[model samples]
Target: MSSHYGQFCPVAKAMELLDERWTLLVVRELMMGSRHFNALRRGVPRMSPALLSKRLQTLVRAGVVERWDDGNRVTYQLTEAGKELEPIVEALGRWGTRWIPELGDEDLDPHLLLWGMHRNVDLEAVPDGRTVIRFLFPDVPAPSRRWWLVISADGVDICDEDPGFPERVGVEGSLRTLIRIWRGDLDWAAALRSGTLTLDGTAQAQRALPRWLKLSPLAGTPRPYAAAG
Candidate 1:
């Protein structure tokens, strides 16, 4: 059966392509500068690699993505048509933030949270030289419970296993609390005051944590209920 709407309406035609599961998300990852397949995988951690590859091929066929082969490494990038979807994607995000703020337990993923946080790190605000930040989500099980972000002049690298760095800052909190903070459902000061989150390490490290780690851009979108307050 064909997925086409068999109509001339532009919206229907677009939905025939974009409405496929994980399709726009692939586009979202591309828009966020994930050029490599592995990087895109991080953005959609729950997606199977085979499914991801299938979506990429679909987008490439639609002329929204371009796959580049430099012999040694292959990378996927958004074509000009894909780039045009940036504002549309961002608008959908903002609308979702404003109107649909509820997140189910299944919606929370520690790996994804770290991926977004690591990507948006404010390198300028973080201290120079090697800075390792450890994240502990005790509520999560096993290997996924612990994580580290090693930042340096070289950039940020996330590790599920200990990087064995001697000096490190610590962030410990329930997964939900941290996700809330990241999504702007809860603020840092409020979480700290309520004892939902904690930061450890040098006083400087504690002070710099919020400054250097940027939250989701949609995190600040004004909600209707918030505006009334």
Candidate 2:
């Protein structure tokens, strides 16, 4: 109400609630199947805990989110009204992919990239037993440069520190290059051929790695440049 534009337009009324910073991002996380509070934080890592809590409370008040407290753990889920925004969020992703093809240096986040990749692990495509893949971003600073993805029948887990498991594969590349590959802005084979990306592991692991970790949801969005070509 306080952020309202005082207009009777439906769009204006919707913007009154949805235009707040981090509001739709919270919804986006929910749409992506992040149910717990900490899991939501991982989706928007840069947002402060206090701000996230506030936003969650606001969403609860708006009836867009339902908070369940079973006394043991509290989980957040989108109400029917909130679930309706999925198409909007997806459309925004596709629009950005096609129009905003270039990324600024500040937009490249290794943490977020790794988190997304972890979520996109194709369980059926990966090996039957536990498989560990280490990703090295040499361009990043220490403590943040190395990451590991441990995948199994249970699920996928990402670790910044060494998980102490024997790594099945190692991928070394610049952060930008890897992000570009994940976003479909660049090709995996092209990056490898240009030496921008390298895989050091068993022949089979290297061959199946790309299939094992499916790229971003919007990666397949056709770009304008490519369409013109």
Candidate 3:
């Protein structure tokens, strides 16, 4: 733990623990139901594994997180105190989506985006069958350009490896456009009409995509303040 504020107050006390770099984001991931260490890293990919381990240990000591060992893998979960931070995390995301300045190239990451979409996609909206959709981001690194979403009644699997299965839909677009679409900054119809996003493969897959993709939960939050400079 870092040095104390040398004073006693609720806000200051909380900040002493949660305000550290990556601390709140770790909490945010835990609140978002990330149970595995690798899963948490997806939400904050730039954070080093060593630093993340340290943060997890710090949070554990702070009684904000709990670890469970099942003989196979050790999973982490937020404790009661950690669960209390859901509103805080939600508020932060809502605020960022509303007031944060316009999107930039640096803000788009295909790996993280695919990881988030894997969890946020509306599985029920997809037709009842094995659906494979390949997303191609032309501007990203070649290795990271292609992402495959294999969705079935069981669950969704995101991978860079080709599953060899016939793709039901192929989406070719830049990462920025996809991010904008996901953030609700750009509408699906507009992207399609503008040709920034291309839809191919089966007709059903293209039709189901709009309904299957449910944007960030905070996407609907309204911005009451002016955009940041």
Per-model lDDT: 0.88, 0.91, 0.85
Report model 1's TM-score to 2 decimal places: 0.96
| Residue pairs of candidate 3 with colliding backbone atoms | none
Candidate 3 residue-wise lDDT at 157: 90
lDDT string, candidate 3, 1-229, tens digits: 7679988899889889988899998998887778998889988998999999999999999999998896798899988998888888888888888878377777788988887788887887887788888999999998898999999988989989899988888999989888877877777888998899999977877877988878877767776654221
- Full-model lDDT, candidate 1: 0.88
Among these predicted structures, which one has the highest TM-score? 2
Clashes of 2: 0
Residue 121, model 1, lDDT:
93
After superposition, the stretches of candidate 1 with alpha carbons farther than 4 Å from their true spots are 227-229
Candidates' TM-scores? Answer: 0.96, 0.96, 0.93
- Give the per-residue Cα lDDT of candidate 2 at 6: 87
lDDT of 2 by residue, 1-229 (tens): 2377989999998888889999999999999999999999999999999999999998999999999985788999999999988999999889999998888889888889998999999999888999999999999989799999999888999999999999999999999999998998887888889898999999999999999989999999988786211
Model 2 quality (TM-score) = 0.96
